[model samples]
Target: MMANTNGYLVGSNLERVLKAGHFAVTAELGPPQSAEGDVIRKKAGLLRGYCDAVNLTDNQTAIVRLSSIAAGAILVQEGLEPIIQMTCRDRNRLAIQSDLLGAAALGIRNLLCLTGDHQTFGNHPSAKNVFDIDSLQMVQMVTAMRDERTFQCGDSFKGPEPRFFVGAAAAPFADPVDFRPLRLAKKAKAGANFIQTQLVYDIPAFEKFMAKVRALGVHKQTYILAGVGPLKSPAMAKYMKSNVPGILVPDELIERMELAGAPWAGKSKEELTKDDKKARSAAWQAEGIQICIELINKLHQIEGVSGVHIMAIEWEDAVRPIVEGAGLSPRPVVTESPPLAAALG
Candidate 1:
């Protein structure tokens, strides 16, 4: 099989675009908590043509939502490329491998592997955890299936195997921050072709993390897309800082949100009509978008950085403006091809 410039035997348009040296763009969309396909389609429509690919999150925050693979298949049917996220929180290796085969069968070509948030964070706090394999092992298992044509048990497949452009996540701002880069290096060595980091707000800290990554030469081995998003409100910022693990929201950003909402900050619920509160909230969101755009511009210049992954996080409508604002609109046209398994067959 002929490999693309990025050196993967099987590559999607995303891989080809990145391999051809375009600044790749990806976005995330959480499937609706309900089983309504229309909701998923609606959100997916908002992202189409705005990004190279859209990520269908896998039970993000451990909340029950439409299955990622199922949602991805819907997006595929809508003529959009979907990166089906798979988390190990709910499934063992058996289910993981089974779903990978099914996802590829449905024409889903990209995947983002993650060790999902603990169930305690979800609506189902009493649910049992089934982390049969960590995210690193998940990467290795999928790589084996794709590149080695073998199952996790080392059993060779008698037929076609799933071909995926595998990805993993990195948290640059996580505790024991100094060790973060090394964790990334381990994932790269384990066969992760690309990485999308956790939400990044503190650039200086991210730059330091990238410095260590470059020093180790892992950047050369895998493409790194810094994660970024728009903060909806000052309360949202505070909640994330206090509740979400590994997220770093600078106090200056919180102050900016407060200032944006200052007009109505002093007003009581009775004094401020719904419109007044809506207008003030919009201000905070607007400032948040601006900050996100600035971060994208800065991250582009960082060495070893390949692209930005915009995670609007329920703010799907904001994606178009953010991408256009950052001058990333009119995404490059890249040719797509059949999966490696089918093409080779």
Candidate 2:
């Protein structure tokens, strides 16, 4: 593990890459439901070098999975940096801080604080939740831990404190549309160093949102990484557009996905053979990747966007082509700098 001698918070690779002004790329790595380190290692192989760092989701969707910190440690061993996600759904402040210390001890330096999805949506629908603190408070808690070397209760650490490059989520098109920007401002005010947004398919809407963001000057306070992903099928696209909260998939993109299946457009399920369905699936995926590449290009032109977060979800292989197609391959490597105090001297 590298020492905290760099003139940056935590000195994580993600922070350095963004500080260097590179349009950074980050991807999601969903840990398996079982206790298999090999699953994480295999996913790391797919993302290594294609992104600055990969986010290990913390029991995403409130389902049980290999712990994010544990999966992150595996990523660290694989020579890939990890952004460990900490959710407020399952743990209280004490558990959160303890796990954070464990993560930092294991060489993980990036943290994404999230108010996780409700437990009713997951397999454990009857499970009790522990929302001791929301994401905003979680951000403030970690920030205090890193900056002031104090616990959430304001108690000073007896030993070296955990340092992190803290992150929070943003949803541009969520409900109360007019207030999304203000919600983001609150996160920035709470001390988020970076913001990874919800999936953005409605470019025009996102542009309008950024207009407000820039007006409030939140972008200048923290780095914003636009989230993107490849649609597996037209059904998948439609489902997200109609069902998912905070995600707005444009009608044109859904139409594009539908058009990709033009060959079997009117065919009934019984009429379509296995091979026909398979072929159509491939075509839709190809179009999806192309669409993602185009979105990345457009996002690059958006003024406040610092980079992109590709949420390829379960389809890790799509990241390579999507990144390469967008001409963001061969990611930059930024060397470490002296600590802040030493640099000041």
Best by lDDT: 2
Q: What does each candidate score in C-alpha RMSD?
A: 3.7, 2.7
lDDT (tens digit, per residue) of candidate 1 on 1-345: 322424445567778767767788899999998989999889988998999889999999989999999999999899888989999999999999998999989998898999999999899999999999999999999988988889999999887889898999999988888899999999999999889999988888889899999999998888899999988999999999888788989899889889999989899889999899889978988998988998899998899888999999889998998899899998888665433432210
Q: Which pairs, if any, clash in model 2? A: none
Displacement of residue 317 (Cα, Å) in model 2 is: 0.5
Error of 2 at 329 (Å): 0.2
Q: How many Å off is the CA of 96 in candidate 1?
A: 0.7
- Per-candidate TM-score against the hidden true structure: 0.94, 0.96
lDDT of 2 by residue, 98-179 (tens): 9999999999999999999999999999999999999999999999998888999999998888999999999899999999
CA deviation > 4 Å runs, candidate 2? 1-3, 336-345
Estimate every model's Cα lDDT from 0 to 1.
0.88, 0.93
The collision pairs in model 1 are none
Instruction: For candidate 1, report its TM-score.
Output: 0.94
Model 1 poorest 10 in a row by lDDT: 336-345
